[model samples]
Target: MLELRLAQGNLLKKVLEPIKDLVNDANFDCTPTCLSLQGHTPMAFVVLSLRAEGFEHYKCDRNISMGMNLTYMAKMLKCADNDDIITIKADDDESDKVHFVFENPNQSKISDLEMNLMDIDSERLGIPEGEHHATVRMPSAEFSRICKDLSSIGDTVEISVTEEGLKFSTTGEFASANIICKHNTKVEKAEEATIIEMNKAVSLPFALRYMNSFIKATPLSNTVTISLSSEFPLMVQYDIAEMGYIRFYLASKIEEAEYEQ
Candidate 1:
């Protein structure tokens, strides 16, 4: 028997939207301290995983690998009776605890909460495991601005990094954008004493998707940190709230177009 209430329903709604693109009919791991799920986008080219843990008193470590279609769930919640507590129920012989809760003040449709337990042993999501070339901290606001500006120029963004500074630029289409942080920028907090170098760029589309997913969970901030390399995934971190943070790893989208001589 578990009962919990959240003040804001939009938070959960927003969290589920982007994830809905990646979460299919898959099993989710639910433990006493957390409820998490990680699934690959059908063919496993892209993966999405989420964990909501340590919010309240929790017990047990039961793995709830139940296949609940996220699209169905999202639609259900959209029209669910926003009553109050989103209750989750658990049955006997409880290998995993299942409970029910309410949305705002309405009741969620019974048909929308269906789930199935299947064999979910292997994990599909994996992070880059390699030595990074450069690591630096900046403001999330600034980073977000760069992404927005680069996106304005074209569908692709080129990130150039060097020991002196970091450059964000875009071209090739009917638009153009560029931003240079020469060792220090007032809009961002740079640690000049450290080894922060870059001379590379990745696609703005991929970066936008990955970065938006990471920073979407919390309030926008002025400070962010990043770790990057020419051949490794870029690591972006943002302080969402007082003590909460969201980190994202975006794979480098290397361009294959040859420049005309």
Candidate 2:
């Protein structure tokens, strides 16, 4: 048996929205302490890793893998409210369906949902940490808005990070626009403060659509983290309060010609 309940259903909503688009089917690796998912998008350009700790309440017979139909799960989560407590349960050996219960304490309302699970066979990437040319942390809303504004002008957005700050820009056939956010040294909430660490300056270009897709996680966390290096995939991570994190790895579009000054 596997059972978990979250204080807020929206946390699960924000976490699954961006991932469901990447793949129709996936697996949720459930343990006594954590539930995690790892898979690539259909196109295979972007990879995702999602982990949510046992918040509120958790119970598991043992370690097990529960296959998920992400599309069905996404649609089911639409019924959830930010304040509603969400609970999930399933018998690891009995049913092919996972059950959900949503409770709104203030409204004295409750709803139940269920979706049939699938047996998904997929490749999971090994995420190895290494030194990055630049690592920056800032308010997630700022990052989401930057991507939104630039995406209106072009399909691709370039991110340049240095000791000074971070820059976001886009270029079209006749126009180019840029925006920069400098690091903030002081802030009351350590989680919301902007911070930067750089070993060397680094710049890379990525699809604006993908960046925008990642913004959906803004509802899940207050701060966003970005890591970039020439030799590795671009990493964008968001911490979901007590629920762990949602991480994305995207390949940068590289051209030696574009690097020429």
Candidate 3:
């Protein structure tokens, strides 16, 4: 048996909203220590890890993988109030359905939902731990705004990180725009500051549509971390307070010259 209770039920709702469009179904791997989901679309891959300690109550008799349709799960979660307490349960041996229970703070309302598990076959990708060429930490809202603004100018945004700062640029048929964020550790709040760590300068173009989708997780964290390397996929991560983190990995677009070669 596996059970987990979360006081802030809205966290699950916020987590699902960003990735439901990108992935149709996913496996939620439950263990004694954590509940994690890993899925990928053609353009992006995502991982959500929620630690057990963050939950109000967490119990696991055995490890289990519960496959679920994210769209349906999101809808069910929508039925819950933002302040409700959410309890999820599944029997490790005989359970074909995962159960969700929601209770309001005043105990005036309670709701329960049962969703059937799926037999989905997915291979988990092993994420390497190598250092990236550059890493930029900035406010989540700032990143979202940059992606939204750049999308209006072009289909793709070129991201460049240097000692000076981080740059987002795009060129449309009629106009071009550049937005640069200079490194600054001094701020009123640490989360509001933009910090950059660069071992080497890196620049690459990525699909703005996907980047915009990734930023849908902006509400989950006050700040977002972006790691970039010329040879690897760009990683955008949002830490969920004391719980865990949601990370989105997007491959850089190949330039016409590189594709031709």
Candidate 4:
């Protein structure tokens, strides 16, 4: 048997939104203390992960890997009100269908649905969060605007991070643009401004599409951390209060010749 519960449906909706964009189906690796997911985008350029700990109202009855269709589940989840307590139930390890129940204590409202599951093969990647040469922790809302603004002019954005601060830039055939954010900006609260550390400066180009997609996670967190190094992939993480966190990793774009001589 497998069961999971959350205090509210909207919280569950927010928890799963970022993953639905990149993955249609996934296996929820459920344990007594946590429920986590690990998967890559269709092209494998970006790796997305979600980690939720079983604390407070969150609970896990028994360890089980529940294969689910996230898209259909998301659709069904919309029927739930923000204050509705959401409960997920599965009969056993071999259960093909899972049940979702939403109840509102104030209004005495109830909604329920059952969805069929699939046999999904899940692979967990060994992505280590090693010491980064350059790490930038900035307000997520600001980062989202920068990505959205630059994406209109170009498909790729260049990130340059140094001990001083961070720079976001992009260029097209006719124009070039750059936005510089210094480490000590008075416009931001001491805790909200850009914080950076580096041994050597690092600049790399990443697809704006992927970045814009990542920015969708802003609703889940107030701050986002960007860890960069020449030897490792770019990592962006958003911590969801006490629940856990969602992380997105995008490999730096490398241009190559069409034919080798």
What's the lDDT for residue 43 in model 1?
Answer: 22
lDDT score, candidate 2, position 68: 87
Q: Which stretches of candidate 1 lie over 4 Å from their true place?
A: 1-9, 22-26, 41-53, 59-61, 79-85, 90-100, 103-124, 182-224, 238-247, 255-261
TM-score of each: 0.63, 0.88, 0.96, 0.89
**Alpha-carbon runs more than 4 Å astray in model 2:** 42-54, 106-108, 187-192, 255-261
lDDT of 2: 0.79
Residue 132, model 1: lDDT of: 62
Flag regions of model 3 displaced more than 4 Å.
255-261
**Candidate 4 lDDT tens digits, 1-261:** 666677646777876777787778888777766777776773233343334453335456677777888899899999888788888878875478888988886757877788888889866777856777888888999899999999888988999996657999999777888998887546446548777778789998888888877887898888899988777778898887776778888777653111121
Over all chains combined, what TM-score does candidate 4 have?
Answer: 0.89
- Best to worst by lDDT, what's the order? 3, 2, 4, 1
Q: What's the count of clashing pairs in each model shown?
A: 31, 0, 0, 0
Better of 2 and 4 by lDDT: 2
Clashing pairs in 3: none
Indicate the TM-score of model 2: 0.88
Cα displacement (Å) at residue 68, model 4: 1.6
Weakest 10 consecutive residues of candidate 1 by summed lDDT: 42-51
- For model 2, residues 1-261, the per-residue Cα lDDT tens digits are 888888877778878887776667788887776787887752223343333453777887798777888888888888877788999989856668888999996758999888888877775567756898999999998888888988888888889987668988899787889998888868778766778888899999888877887887788888999998988778888887755778887777674234442
Evaluated with TM-score, which candidate comes out highest?
Answer: 3
Can you write out model 1's per-residue Cα lDDT over 37-147, one digit (the tens) per residue? 555432222223333442332334455555566787677566644434343445546534344444454344432253334455666466567766656666555666677
